[model samples]
Target: MRASRFFALRERGTDARTEALGGLATFLTMSYIVFVNPAILSSAGLPFDAVAVATALAAGGFTIIMGLTTNLPFALASGLGINAVVAFDIILGRKVSPDVGMACIVLEGLLAVVLVLAGMREAVVRAVPTSLKLAIGVGIGLFIALVGLRDGGIVVNDPSTGIALGDLSTGPALIALAGILVALGCAAANVRGAILIGIATSTVLGLVFGVLDGPSAVARWPTSGDFSTIGDGLAPGALRDALTWALVPIIFSLFMTDFFDTVGTAYAVTSAGGLLDERGEIPKVRNLLLVDSAAAAGGGAMGVSSVTTYVESGAGVAEGARTGLASVVTGLLFALTIFFVPLIAVVGQGVTVGKDTTLHPAIAPALVMVGYLMIQLVREIEWDRPEDAVPAFLTIAGIPLTFSISAGIGLGVFGYVVTMIARGRVREIHPIMWMLVPMFVAFFASNWLSAHVF
Candidate 1:
């Protein structure tokens, strides 16, 4: 009896060890996005450091909520779409006050809350066809891969020259790219902590090449001196005019992007993890939606413009994590990094000339992934049935070209509807799809009206 007890105890210990390792792996996988996202957003004049800290906390809280409510392993954060809107459109283009932006964020969160309580979340997911979900997953993968490639210097911007080779012959940039590529290759080959390894290697190479020298490299943690006025710079009343005009577009972009991004990520990660049940559905999806909504709401309170689920979390999900334990671990690690924001910001600035410079390494990876996914999509679609393939093909290609994911999706949906009508399959299409026609008309008409009216 004592011998049997000893064996049981040992088994329990082994299980615990396994759980711990799984959690740690998840945290490591997500850390890259968590760290880099804020830095990128901040370069556009938003309070990146504070937003980073808040996002981490919000993510942790939401993760805990999901675990308690649904028992499904998932985490949340400011989404890529929101980050782009905040960086490019709101901060730079419209010059809206960050305070007003935060207010809009809060409203979006409230809308998400309503969405969850109304059971719309699950209903929409259920309503979406599998083919669209697949396209979304592939699209997100391509999007993120493009982001990585651009940051890594594999792609560059030139209006006159168009797409061409970047300055890869340089020391630091070349070293960083090589290091990241080597690390990614290792990860693909089953090496653990691939991203961290890549970052460290690049950092070292950066130092050796004198790219990360001077005061920029030596700045202390939680660097708040330069941003002392951030908290006090609220021009809420002054922002109303701008906010009024921009609100519709901002909200529309945020909702469309976040909704699809979350859906696509959930589908992709669940598929990769082999977590889909016999019915090809994720279990306890309601709880995941709730967690996501709550995180967005929390992000608004913390002054970040938009918070949503991360599609890149698929990287962790692909690595064998099966429980919310992974999310919890990731959240905790992000919380700890709050103290090092200054150091990170400083280091980030030192290595990359500006925020755009930091984006060089990510560009190549993005292109490669997009190319790969497009190939896969072409193979999967029923090309002989041009009615189906043409629409899907357009959706896949239109996103990057149009510079708007929603517009791309909108075009795809419109194409699908037109094709269905042409093929005499109109009855098979959902009634909600009819809504697309008017939306398309309205969207383009508004653009035309704006050009002429203004």
Candidate 2:
């Protein structure tokens, strides 16, 4: 068959029907991004509808690219952690415009590709401790949960203490809590599409409680206006602005997150499918990395955030998918969602909770569920060893507390280097890890330097 010949289905031992089923499964598992992404980006002043459009477009287009180029089942989308960095750290915290924030992602993506081509990843990958890499994902998971809580109106800024529990009595908070419970129930039942299911349930409850407005239309054809945010990162001066000295560490942090996440996701997903080669490495992994890296830049260029391969692709692989055909099916599903942006906006649209706080009661459940899922990485760290324990603790705590992924990473690096020296392992530290110490210092003090020196 043409399909079998094109995707090597026969060699991979997966039929076209099986591949289709796998792709459908994958799409169902990770499709929650269509609603959640716009809700997060809109917090940084981007339009909700436009960002929703961009998210679907970038996810669909790049996922297809991944399938075509690498012949892998990995799916791509706006990454959750990287989106937080763009929305909260760079855009809001550093006072840079949204376009400039995305420009940083574009640069990070391009740099990642260059590093891959130059074969310079060995030293950089080996330099960081395994515990730290694991902790970054765990910390970002906590950070995402915190954002979910705030968005759900389950947590609020306290004048006396930094944060306090919100009034669970409110409609939005109650709806969010209900949604979270539903998600947990679904997960416990081993249901596929638990996150998306939770979001749908929450939206229904929000509508019932009058906490969310209904959509004006169910579906509509996308227009040029719907894609207005495309290429915003490449606007004149945006790239140049992202090249400043102050943003050096920020970009580096983004690159690290993008790079490490792909490495981990690729390994785990491929391993699950029994696809690793004799050396215990993924086949054509370089192509996988290349497509993943380009997706990051493509996402930024499309005015979303950095896109990366999703572990959710494992859903497809588990269902007998062994080639890119499954990815093509998943990508097509994502593209079809663009027409339903109006329905999606109903969930993305938030409720006004206070004078200034807008609560996204419908979308909060998915974010909370995703955070819970990511936090599972915490168990992999060897907690008894102080050298690893301290840095991992700092990283896991710093991200949500400081509300800065990069700052949390900086703290972890500092703790790692300090602990290594104190443990008499000074000479064992990789030169690259040592180099990161001063860079993180500059990152931590960039604001001060900008005000006084630079």
- Top candidate, metric TM-score: 2
Please give the lDDT score at residue 357 for candidate 2.
80
**In model 2, how many backbone clashes occur?**
0
Point out where model 1 deviates above 4 Å.
1-16, 214-243, 312-320, 350-388, 444-446, 449-454
Query: Given candidate 1, what's the lDDT at residue 324?
Result: 57
Q: What is the C-alpha local distance difference test score of candidate 1?
A: 0.59
lDDT of each: 0.59, 0.86
Model 1 TM: 0.81
For residues 1-454, write the lDDT of model 1, one tens digit per residue. 4522422324323233443455566666555545555655675765656666655655666655654565444666666546656666666676766666656566566677788789986777876655665565455555555555556665667788765556888654585576667676766687776666666566566666666542343334555543332322234563344346436556555666677667766776676667787898977787777677766656656655456665445555555556555555566766676666655553344246456555423222223433343334344456677566766666767666665677667777777888888889989887656765676565545556455553
Candidate 2 lDDT score at position 22: 94
lDDT of model 2 at position 303: 84
Q: How far does residue 285 in candidate 2 sit from its true spot (Å)?
A: 3.2
- Which candidate ranks first by lDDT, i.e. highest? 2
Q: lDDT by residue for model 2 over 1-454, one digit each (tens)?
A: 8878989998998899999999999898888888989988898998888899899989998998899888889899999878978987789889999999999999999998887777666446546787887787788778878888888989999999989999999999998889889998998898877888888888998888788888899999988888988998988799999999888778888987788777756766787798988976678877887788888888888889999988789889988899999999999999999999899999988787668787788888888887887787788789999888999999899988988777887899899989999999999888888888888887788779777776
TM-score of each predicted structure versus truth: 0.81, 0.92
